[model samples]
Target: MNASDQNALVIEGGNQLKGEITPQGAKNEALQILCAVLLTEEKVTIHNIPDIRDVNQLISLLEDLGVEIHKIGDNSYAFQAKEIDITYLQSEEYKAKASSLRGSIMTLGPLLARYKYAKIPKPGGDKIGRRRLDTHFLGFEKLGAKFNYNSDHKYFEIDAHDLRGTYILLDEPSVTGTANVIMAAVLAKGTTTLYNAACEPYIQQLCRMLTSMGAKITGAGSNLLKIEGVEQLSGTTHTMLPDMIEIGSFIGLAAMTQSEITIKNARIDELGLIPDIFKRLGIQMEFRNDDIFIPEQEHYEIDRFIDGSILTVADGPWPLFTPDLLSIVLVVATQARGTVLIHQKMFESRLFFVDKLIDMGAQIILCDPHRANVIGLDRQIPLRGIKMTSPDIRAGVALLIAALSAKGTSTIYNAEQIDRGYQYIDKRLQALGANISRI
Candidate 1:
């Protein structure tokens, strides 16, 4: 939070987001790659990095620990972490920035692997639900890492005398959990295989980056991964994959406002099933050499099955509609001409943000903590904008979609919520020809 009397964003609604936009690099991927710098005392270069708040904060922490960070160019950084000082890590300023990121807990794995010890505080992120660290702890324990947690706000330590690799199975396919174990196991004493691990694009990118740096890893982008531990790893230059979530957000923005949009370098193959999922909401897209073009459609209708059955959009581990973009899909579903069921199978409280949409005149029935039924009005009555506050990253983007397509002006307090994940959201939306400004 920057020091100020009070600064908030005021948005005048009913302006469609038109024109072309390219997504910044993947935030999730950048976090993992940045932490990989601790694997060895070598210079690593990360290209196509997103200049978001989280990335900047993590870069600051890395530099504070004696890592030589140089901004080679825009969205590109070179890091050489030859030494680290954990005693200087206890500073409140660094700790606050470090703990503010959800992926900060991942530092434990790399620190333990290199220094044989790591003491990181409980990390913080969107308060959508309970993001537990039990999986992370259990995964490290399997790799010969011991943990001691003291709630007195001091002396939480993890020590590994020798990392003996073992077969580890995640209770749930947690993205960060898989990343942590992989980071720790890459420099372990033996071969490590992870089953039931999260294999999202972000996780796959991390695996690829590790492999490029001389870590022998297989089965990336799949449930099972085999990593051959190495005594040391060397630096390498790697580019992050395009952000599918940002692509989905732009798709939603275009559809909600009935505008055409083209996303450059979209990595259509990496999208897997996202294209077909958006098609269900009457959002048509054209693929052109790693680019996705969403054409303007006057008639938006949710496509029913051949049997005229109600369409159901559900999220799962992978090869399914991602939980990350479910909120954006739900907002688009609100304007389509039909009914759809959104089933959020992963998190419990993720769907609760729909209440704000209902207030904006969208018809949505909350089935429970994990499900919602949305009945689109087909733009019968224009949504009236109302002042609101951003709850989380995805939900904030959804609200922005709602407000941008609504009738009157809307003010979203705490614009910082959106800043945490997306880099320069308003400016990017403006680049897409959207009439949006931050106050």
Candidate 2:
């Protein structure tokens, strides 16, 4: 659903939202963790699972694979892959379901590791940029898996008869790619040393959970990871961290709306560089235990480089600001007091949403597909709401933020894109006094 989808968000803009909002479980981490459940036959109890579209879609795909799924709570599930239907991998139904969301790509590692065969249609998600599966297939090939792609059917398959681990130096530090390789390596016969791995908190959480399931893994939060393959794994209960991307988005929303909002259970210790990066935008936030207190501000200023140069906010590997939050940052800068360069180095098409913001009266120069120069209005002229369409998940949320701060009402089409990542976003924002409704 790109723009013609009937799932739209009608937002009455210029409302100063208040109260506390708790973020849902981390969506990125949940995808990898849920796939990891396939590695062990025991019951894997996972709490803090978000009830979002993509995750739910993946859960349905797991059900198609004959994994025993039991919902223990509103946001908790116990999964047992004891009787996986391997034959389902060849069915047309499996192809369509697996192609619906990009998260299905993670299942390949576990299925190939345990069953020695796995096939999936080319997974789909946001069309922000080109995301290749080379790292995943190349890593698998290094671990004794024969990779094949049937271009006619738009699906790929892997055959792993005898899995043995070896040294792997990834060409790029991709989080999901790293996760797929790690999951496959955990059940290999020999030691697997993975260098240039993605050290995001999501990957670290996966490592911890895999360790609890009897996998021998070291370097949970570093680029260099070593895993001694274990014969089998036992299930264990694990809790997911709050979505840091949501936390960052909430902070941006509070500043954009000038609302006094508190983000509960943000797990600040785990939010590395997020708070400080927002501080770069001059958005003041207070940390009270695990909660983040965002005070209403009439005007916020953007900080410049120490050499009196324009501050350039760029995305890179972890510990650096994330590319996922760059859209939110771009929106937050629209109403800020100064000019800053938003360099979205990761995905070329990610910065394309600025055109919608420009139509809504934002002073943004799309320097190229990769960079944008946002000269803020500083709230002197409030943004005028207009009808727009959400292109992807992060951009959808970013446009929502822009609409919340704009004057008059705004209608956003294709809101299902937003629902893919954020859990009940309209309801949660409504709880915080936002004038938004999903239609």
Model number with the top lDDT = 2
Q: Each candidate: what lDDT?
A: 0.85, 0.94
lDDT of 1 at 325: 93
In order of appearance, the predictions have TM-scores of 0.96, 0.99
The regions of model 1 sitting more than 4 angstroms off are 1-7
Judged by whole-model lDDT over C-alpha atoms, candidate 2 comes out at: 0.94
The sequence of per-residue lDDT tens digits that candidate 2 reaches over residues 155-227 is: 7989998889999999899999999999999999999999999999999999999999999999989999999
393 Cα displacement, candidate 2 (Å): 0.4
Clashing pairs in 2: none
What is the per-residue lDDT of model 1 for residues 1-439, given as tens digits with 9 covering 90 to 100? 4432134566677775677789889887888888889887889998999988787878887888778889999999989989888776667766676667776777788887888888776788887788888888998889988888878874456888788889998998888889989999999999999999998988988888888889989999899999899988999888998888888998888889888889999988888888888888888899988889999877689998889998888888776678889999899989889999999888888998888898899999999998999999898877778878788888988999899888888877777878878888888887767667787
